[model samples]
Target chain A: MTTYYLEYLKLKKKLRSWLGPIIVFILIMVAYPLTVEFLEKDLEKGFYSLLWISILLSMMFSTEDIFLEDFNDGTLEQIIISSSSFPFMIAKKIFIYWIMIGLPISALSFLFSLGITKDLNLSLFVIFLAMISSYIFLNLFVFGSALSLNKGSVLGALITMPIALPVLIVLGKSIIALQFGINYLELLLLLLGCLSIIISTVPFIVSYVIKAHLE
Target chain B: MWGLFFTPEDFVQGNSYRIIYLHVPASFLSQSLYAAMAIASVIYLVWRVKLAAYLIISIAPIGAIVTFIALFSGSVWGIPTWGTWWQWDARITSTLILFIMYLGLISLHASFSNYEKADKLLSWLVIVGFVNIPIIKKSVDWWSTLHQSASITLTDKPSIDPSMLYPLIGSIIGFFGLIICLVILSSYVQILKRESTKSWLKDYV
Candidate 1:
């Protein structure tokens, strides 16, 4: 268990490599909102547009981290052979990822949401939804990157995007509902339920794929 | 087979509800075929059964085709009732999503070269994909605007009329029979492709 904590620290130390994808993705996040404004000519459109693009871009970037270093260096093989509980350990790594990558982006999205919705309550919901949505994307990315470890980012996007679309629609609908003062609890619960289901299952899938590829 | 020819027509829908004979069966197999793929995947992962892996490989394209059939029939049925070829309704959207996921599985399976590693990855894809079934099933009941509530469930008494219900039952059975035949044919060819040098193929090849 503590070993996973050490793995998390080593992963964070590798952030310098991610700087490129992060900067580029953040630029996209900021730029996409401008397009939304051009259509509606409304600044508030920035909030929802930012949240959606940011969550997706964050996912696209962070997923690159899932198997890159370990697989590239042959460390993943040794780790898999040593640990009987690879999936749980990987789950911990995902949690740490959510903390490092997902949390900051969620916070940024919340600030943007506040600018668009102009409602503190809805913005906060945006933050909460951002976090859970990121968690979903991260887990799905873990699955995608494991399969596409050598296949490149296009395959990763191809694999995860279709699976993530339904979840995205649910989250987007709830956010839009919140903006309109519609009751959102049902949608919120549904989103959370789907999140929990993804949480419990995806790690095991990733672990099996990782082990298989390592072998 | 008897029910297909014998069922009474819906008063409002006239003969168009007849599409349900094809639509409902395709939808049922589309969803169940996914479950079968997931189960085959689970069996392959746990046991490393080559046959189960073949099931996973063969099941995907079949699942995709059935998903397409369901969508096609639903859209055909939709044109008369909804006055549009496609509506962004919840049930309809989820089914489209389901079809795309099946396509993802096929693409992912095709991308890899190593049969052994591919089997594991394929199983992983199907098992992870099992999550979509419930979302698709409940989408209509959860949101009320478009697509009507499901008229039949395994446990609940079907809300459908008996005259109409019997044909649906026959169509579902017939569809399953057809799918089973197709699966057997595909799996046999796949095995031959993979095991062409084996002694078992001496008899057939």
Candidate 2:
């Protein structure tokens, strides 16, 4: 457990060093609002809509970092050789990656929501759901990135996103509903079910693929 | 078997219904091709079998062609029966998505110059996208969707008339044979391309 936290901290440091989170924040938090404001007169629908869209794109941008850098730098091999279990290491890396990427994006999304909808509670709900969905998505993305370690970035995203579509659709719809103040309990449940599946299954999938790639 | 080949005397659509021969088979082969891709992807992921990658690349274009035929014929059939060029029926929509997945695989494979990376990426996509096929197939049945139910199956006789069934089965067999031939031929080409740098490919190339 302590090891996992330490590994998580190390990953967070690496992500910060890579400057991915900073660029993603600027793209989602700052640039998105400016674009929406420029596009529409009302800026209400445009603001809320672009906020979610920015979150999705930012998640995608960070996914490429999942395995590529480690594969390139040979740190992945070192982690595999470490006393720490490989699956645990992978879970830590994914968790940290999701935290660094999803957390800030979700925070910005909440602020964006406040700016657009002007309802703090609803904004928090939207951010909460988005954060959960993004966590599941990042796990699946990490699994795919590991499996397709040899594949190029664009192809990897294409492969992963289709499988991840159900989750994304449910999340997107729920966020839309939340913004509109509609009851979206069913969509929320569906997204939660998907998140549960990812949590339980993704580690095994990642481990199996990593082992296969090593061989 | 002799009677099976003979056309029914009381046929309504006439010999042009014979196109069902081509259409049905193409549909069957397309589904089979997707199934094969799914299975190959699983094996590749599980066992890291390079041959599965070759099989995926070989079958994808053929699958795309089969899917195209299915949509084209369905549109043609729709014109006569549904009084329109196309409808957003469950079967059509699902099949369209399947076609998109195939196109996705083809484009993904072509995007990469490195053959090895292309194989890995496409295999992953194939595995992931194949999960949606069953969902697409049952979406109509599960929901009050517009698509028609499946035609032929193990426990059930086909819903269509005998006049339609015979040619449909014949075309299906022919299409299967043709697709098999194409897969084998293309797989040979793939082998040649990949192994061409080898001394053995030198003999063939």
Best by lDDT: 1
Name the top TM-score candidate: 1
lDDT of 1 by residue, A1-215 (tens): 68767877776788753454456556765676566545434656545755675687667777776778778898777778784578887888888788777877788777766655567998788888888888888888888888878877567666677678777778878877887889999998988987898899888878877878877
The list of candidate 1 runs beyond 4 A from truth reads A1-17, A20-29, A36-50, A83-85, A176-201, B1-8, B155-157
Model 2 segments more than 4 A misplaced: A1-53, A107-125, A147-152, A172-187, A207-215, B1-28, B44-53, B71-97, B103-125, B142-146, B151-159, B191-205
In terms of lDDT, model 1 sits at: 0.80
The docking category that best describes candidate 2 is acceptable
Residue range B1-205, candidate 1, lDDT tens digits? 5555667767898777888889898988889999999999888878878999998888889989999999999999989888887988788888888898889888887888877777788788787777789888888877775788889988999999988887788888989999999999889888887787788788776
DockQ of 2: 0.26
Against the native complex, each candidate's DockQ, computed on alpha carbons, is 0.50, 0.26
True-vs-predicted CA distance for residue B171, candidate 2, Å: 2.9
User: Model 2 scores what on Cα lDDT?
Assistant: 0.70
